[model samples]
Target: MADLTDRGTEVGPGEFAPWPLLTMHLGGHPLDQAQLQQLLAWELANPERAAAWGITPANGPGQLQERLDWLQALAPRHGDLPLPPAPLEQCLPLYWQLWLPLALTLKQARDELNRPLIQGVLGVQGTGKTTLTLILQHLLEGMGYRAVGLSIDDLYKTYRDRQQLVQADPRLRWRGPPGTHDIDLGLTTLAHIRTAAAGEAVALPRFDKSLHGGQGDRSDPEWVRDVDILLFEGWFLGARPIDPSGFDRAPAPILTEADRQFARDMNAQLATYLPLWDCLDRLMVLCPADYRLSKQWRKAAEHQMKALGKDGMSDAIIDEFVDYFWRALHPELFIDSLKRDGEHVDLVVEIDRDRIPRAIYSPALAMI
Candidate 1:
């Protein structure tokens, strides 16, 4: 119901090119019959993708066509949507397949829970967690729900506090690892967003990673009210601690007693942050087919920065940066634990090296 323009300025039709929905659904409406045929033809060419998303050859066509028709009608309500910050067109082919299910999941939860919901999105660096959240926010808004996003990075302790950490232990200089975030701040913010009165405002904290020469620090606050849903995303959002025995033989490159000790310490630190995870009604993990892809993605990001004529981390620095995360907490082990035992993790969207969403696994929903 809201206009796409900044400050809610009214923009007449044709003021900006209406960004057409490449896929069938635009919000929730479907496409026309001719467009539906085109979409079906595209899907037919990608049978492997159809199977991956649980679309069978028999019922998939009709089912998809129905959803496409719904999206066509829903498009005008959102007006011309803005393009994403990154070049994610490669993944657009699977957009509706993923987005529609997620939208339904949230709507179902909202109808059942009868209150605002806080959903946690877990993904390693460069897996497009923020992009997915932003997309969901747009889709949810078009569905008449007010959604807001909060990053775990925004909860990092103040610059002064992190400097104290450096004094305490120089290895703690980098901020992504456990023990760097202010868990209380995240907990309180979620609580406010989940329960704030209609007129009550909530000030969300923000961190400026570009400040202090990339050491990063908290910046100003962003205030919002009437958030029907909260998307709290971070690389290690729902990570759990591994057993102490699992640290016996530290992974390679970690070949040191001190490194093993640091791993244990970080694992212990994860427990202190569990109360924050308790706030999530559901958790969605964006998993890569290969965990090592993060290294390549991070490197590519640095190269992109260099192309922009900005200071960027060198190859060696990038290696250390990516390795620090593994040393802090191995994503494979933590994510596997959550997948097997986490009560909150309801969806897992597997991503391939090409950044396309290959499949979605929903264990809880399947049981239902």
Candidate 2:
């Protein structure tokens, strides 16, 4: 109920109230209202010292009065607005706080733009990769840099084509894995964006979670070229070719008897796509803390989908689907990718199994 404009300066309708300006010691935390008032009272009592500190009697009194008034107004509102349950706020901060360093590094890279740069973000399901990409887009735009987000999921070949692969091998439940996507379309789109041509538009496909197929009408196309940045993000964006020799030793639980055979067959077909990572300017892996955390995050993601009105996906279904890829989803493989390709991948922030920051990986430091 406090009005911001009553003190000579006019505030627009629905404008937020001005916050108080109270400075503490150079390296100290901000002063609370009581401390600020005590300081102001002490300063006013000693005019000679206040003047020596560059506080003129006329303006100093007015500024101190404004600070007192703003504090009085802020108190009631601060008490009225509900604070989040402490635990929720605690975990929530961990979600974004862990990524701040990586975000800062990426922002710095964007600032040093000499040529076009394409940044790819890699994560398994529910690792917040898409959300991170959206956050990056927002931050880049805030910094006066242009960024376009394109998900590999959006380039899945026609629904009809994907369905055939699933039908051909019932083991392939969802059309998300490597061979199921339209690699040709994805590569072509990336090439178009890279070359800086105008009038070239590529229609990106959209997935329909309710029907477990394409939405039929949701396709995003970039008509104009010369885009500064393209954020290509997906579950397996940086997945390397599974060395055939390692397949024999892969855990049996990771692949069912049928899935093991299917993976072997599919890997042969996916050989062509292995070189796609070479085209990336940089690869960023959002490595989960561990398999357990990854699974929990995946389940939480499924619940979020339900809240958003998506159907055909329940916790049970998510659990079952996750089981199929458990064997193939290796954090070690990702770690190796970061080690071998550290130069091409500017930064890797290793999150713990608890989703807390473990260490940061950079080419110069290797591990920080």
TM-score of each: 0.80, 0.64
lDDT of each: 0.73, 0.55
**Tens-digit per-residue lDDT, 1-368, candidate 1:** 01112221223775421124453244444456666555566555655445434555576667675455435544454333344332223333444557654765676577788888888999998888887787778777877888889999999999999999879988896888889999999989988888889979999999999898777889989999888888899999988787888778766545688778888899999998899998889888887878888888888888989999998989899899888888888766677666555356777877777666666666454444
Q: List, residue by residue over 133-157, the lDDT tens digit for candidate 2.
A: 7656654554466677888777776
Which 10-residue window of candidate 2 scores lowest in summed lDDT?
A: 1-10
69: Cα error in model 1, Å: 4.6
Please tell me which predicted candidate would have the highest TM-score against the true structure.
1
* Clash counts for the predictions, in order: 14, 3
| Model 1 lDDT, residue 248, Cα | 85
